[model samples]
Target chain A: MSDMRDMFVETASRLFRDYCTPDLLRAAAAGSFQTQLWDAMVEAGLTKAAVAEDAGGSGAELADALALLVPAGANAVPAPLAETLIAGFLLGEAGVVVPDAPLTIAIPRPGETLRAVRKGDGWLITGAVARVPYARFASGGVTVIAETAEGPLLAQVALADCKIAEAANLAHEPRDDVAFNEAPAQAAKLTTRQAADVYAMAAAARSAQMAGALQTVLQLSVQYALERSQFGKPLGKFQAIQHNLATLAGQAAAATAAADAAIAHAEHGAGSIAIASAKARAGEAASIACNIAHQVHGAIGFTAEHALHFSTQRLWSWRDEFGNDAFWELKLGDQAVAAGADGLWAMLTAAA
Target chain B: MEALSFAPPPVSEEAERVRAEVRAFLKTELANRPPFKKADSWNGADPAFSRKMGAKGWIAMTWPKQYGGHERSALERYVVLEEMLAAGAPVAAHWIADRQSGPLILKAGTEEQKQSILPRIAAGDCYFCIGMSEPDTGSDLASVRTKAVKADGGWVVNGTKVWTTGAHIAHYMILLCRTAEPTANRHEGLTQMLVDLKATDGVQINPIYDLAGQHHFNEVVFRDAFIPDSAVLGKPGDGWKQVTSELALERSGPERFLSSFTLLVELVRALGPDPSPAAKIAIGRLVAHIYTLRRLSRSVAGMLQRGDDPAIQAALVKDLGALVEQEIPEIARQLIAAEPDTKSTSDFVAVLAHTVLNAPSFSLRGGTREILRGMIARGLGLR
Candidate 1:
């Protein structure tokens, strides 16, 4: 990372540490968006951190911006910050002006065509969005891939124009279903990627988020082990608990490494295998890490009053959001099989 | 937050180039290698095969060129090591010397020792064995009672070293012996002595076969083995420090995770491209694990190359690696119904059999899981 990237990370870290408190997270979970937190992040230029400078935003490198997601997610900042960054990038690419409001992205299922035809002065959009993150709270708009008469295009459509049946994920954040029946869309940019690329992008982002959440839960578990005493000793002193925490640490490290691999490969072009590996590995890590953390925390972590669930619940939700372990496992395993025994080595080594 | 830092280190383009070359070489070299032999990974020795690697300057890769090394970067060496392990190359003949012992000599041995021994090690012709575990010592390495009394020129050693891998085949042993009486600190007064296995008069090497009847482990006893003044590695009392310093070098590597890689390759082969969703998920889990482990292992390599001590990180890699590795056979057991048989000609069954028998020792060697967890706990500031 360059000095500028380091500064960006430091600023984001300090901001989250100062503002993203447990109270803020709890309030955000209870159906209230944290405007002050989002405003602070926006003022810091982090909201448009993924957009191009020529498109009117902080033009941080893709990998650099993605890396910041780790610390942001680690802090449990309780906002649609990553969504806004991604949405802003997509909007900027289409020459659309990014709004001051918070943003969310809608991921379509694999191989379902989205159509937008010319209607009056605007475009008529027809698509069904499932598991749309922050759909109820995307104040700026939603970034979606739709098929127009001009072929596939990345377009920005407002939330108010679409019919949304709001839902929530395991973490209590919005995962609404949005139906765009001839909803007005504009400033669309042409794209070549399919639903798979969208899945990869979402997977990459979620993998980073999972890495951050797992790291925090590991810290929580370790802290709990150090404080909670039984049998005349701290839990950390017991070999069984120590081994469990050690295993947790290993899982956390693996998750972090997988995320890093995704970020690094994103530095190159179109990260396919790296994204698959990241999502699959990080999801597995999240499963192991979350289970061990809860086990280590005992009954304390099960309560809503405790903060461990803030991260663990988010991990549970995020692992399945973009593409779950089973979803990506087939993709990677299929690729590995097609690669054959001879091609497997090349695929593994090609990441370098 | 400051606990075990395993940030995936960046590899250079040079390392990637090295990877391509290594892969191409392995494709040609291992085209006809049997799956059973490949399943042994680093423990399967072939002197001729090792020499082939030596001819390519793949051994002692990160060492200085004067020591018969290729003068490659640590990341470059890492690429080579991982590619070999993944391909199940027979690297046992030079694995120890290239991975740890030669590096120890380079770090702490005298110039004369470096010139005399490191070149042979780098050449891949000279094999070395670890003499850390005594008959009474396993994870309690500090409890070693092997003693060497001060003599005319240097010392006369007498002790029994058990579970010494490759003792029957290795040319030299980096033996750790107590030079003085153990005080409150058992690690105190210990010394590392270079032993010539063939030339040593009082040494006896006896086979200690494992459950699978492999010949790697041995019990070597010395009655009155002579060590000259130049044979001492590092300072006498600093043996503990020296041995522990080289541990991260030994623990974190592709070998730790890639021991079961052949089984994975065979699993993939058996499943073909279109297995059931259950099989895909199972294999994908293993793929995810191996990929993550490889990244962690590479990060350790980067740290080692930068001359940093990543002991805690190495422990984490080894422990998690063993867990996933040991789990491979179990998972493969469910994914495929073939009965494991070492004598079977079927690649999948043979590799599965080989891995099932050896999986128990993954955590047992390179410090047990309990010990590694203890180290990790200390790293986390828990102890």
Candidate 2:
């Protein structure tokens, strides 16, 4: 186990240092998503790293997948690679014939209704899903739908079946509103509960990404503190900046640890306890990391020219992407209470 | 550098069985003990109970059997520590010697020292206290002015150690004092000596009552105290190295954080089935932080087992863990209404009282927040 963790640390460090350099992050922020980097990850088997080997990919565990994503996040890579990989894996896990291409899952907005009806050989998906991340770039999409008789279902629909309207999220990710009008779709074997489970897992993965991004921002901020001089010394020489960076480092470490633990639990079928915990911690940490990086960088971090904006912006977006910190917090608390006193004690003791 | 990744090592079957055994022990032996009471676990220090644990070979599970040690793996020891702390057992009596002093002596002490001390410590028949801090030198150990002069195969030590927990009851103290001349470097010429507490020759232990009127802490003065050269831990001038390594053990552990865990459990219980939104949020945040800290701490333990001293990482865990623990009381206060009178004997309320009283020491003990942050910043290369 120690070796595995060390391997993760080694892999993550290399990815961040060599691939997710400041220039690369800046390019990502400027919408110059590196196709070479994406392709390199794919060739390195990182894209479908969590999928079973039987499904034409490395059967890496969830932790391994998360380990890869952390660096992807720290670099603020603009491609929706994480989302695509997750959507593909879920579809493949459910025995769906995942297309040999990138896929993205669109989160259903409040008041949005997705209805599916049986057709001759497939189903017709009707309704609009809002805030679909990387919708325009996906070859297909995995969307949530409510069926009248069959209940909640996750269906895989080709991008050709839906219209992707150009949209920009707060963090400048290329999102879009996916509008489906009786589009032909194939229902995967995933139920509504399973879909919710998948959503939670995806949220956990995205949280890992956010954690990675936050860690990067922290490192960058620390580096800036060392390089930038104040009164006769590096800015880092000041206790105030030192304290700020320490706090940020603590938060980043906490978030990273939480995400890793969550992935471990999820892989072992531990349910929402782990996912909710990771999501909550990562969400909060990402927001704080962004704020701290900007604060430490001062005016330079806020400017468009600095690379810090790349990670900071991604931190803001990824935090809200999978579910905000508040949402996950509620989920975790409700789950704990539902487990009752004895259950809570058992869980705490087990963790301890 | 590879991508940032965290894949915990797999748990062994023996470790799993050990965890079960410890769990069973807690359920049976510690069933009646309140969770909050168990919060201190070993730090709660009841001599009789600690002696019982020693008898059961639970005190020094990982030590060599020849020296009254169990010679278990660090992971197995880790399991035991986690179980004991989770159950909130009274382990305070033997915690110090079992944790550091005994280990230090085993590694650096002469065969005679090990033969004399290890068995007693393993038996929980002896206790030890840290004698490092002075009135003027808080976090700055090199700034210590306590003097120890060589005198015919022995040393004459004279100094005052303040904020020493368990000083009143400890049988001995592992004192770090200046053994040579003060020089340009603050870390030069120091030594760790084991001083017997029962000696009335020139030592005085005075109680320093805390805000809660608790006498858990004391100030000990050693005037003309004689200590044989054999009493020194490691080589003379190795005190700085020994002390720094000891701090890693001190700062990183389940105890550094989770001090107020009993209250957190109580708060959840008090909330019942349906909790307010605010309460839910607070509890969720707390649990998340706890989970995160546990992983980080565990990883540090893994590092230690591999012969690595993760001082910076340990400091990071301690600083963050302390803050999370300190916040529990405040969050609990806002979540649950205060029962002014003794209307409720709920475990939650009792745990709250205990945590509120102890929270201040979370950051103060081991190392102050200011000192820890400085270390962390330096670790990050900020300074």
At residue B357, give the lDDT of candidate 1. Answer: 94
TM-score of chain B of 1: 0.98
Give the Å error, residue B334, model 1.
1.5
> lDDT tens string, model 1, B19-135?
889988998999999989888879989999998988898998988988888888998988888889888889998888888899999999999999999888877799999999987
- DockQ, per-model, please? 0.65, 0.51
lDDT of 2 by residue, A181-258 (tens): 988775544364444565677777887787777777887888888898878998888998888888888888878878
**Cα distance off (Å), candidate 2, residue A143:** 5.5
Model 1, A128-244: lDDT tens per residue? Answer: 978788888887887787876676667788778878998999888888888988888855667775445765776787888888888899899999999999989999988888888
Return the TM-score for each candidate structure: 0.97, 0.92
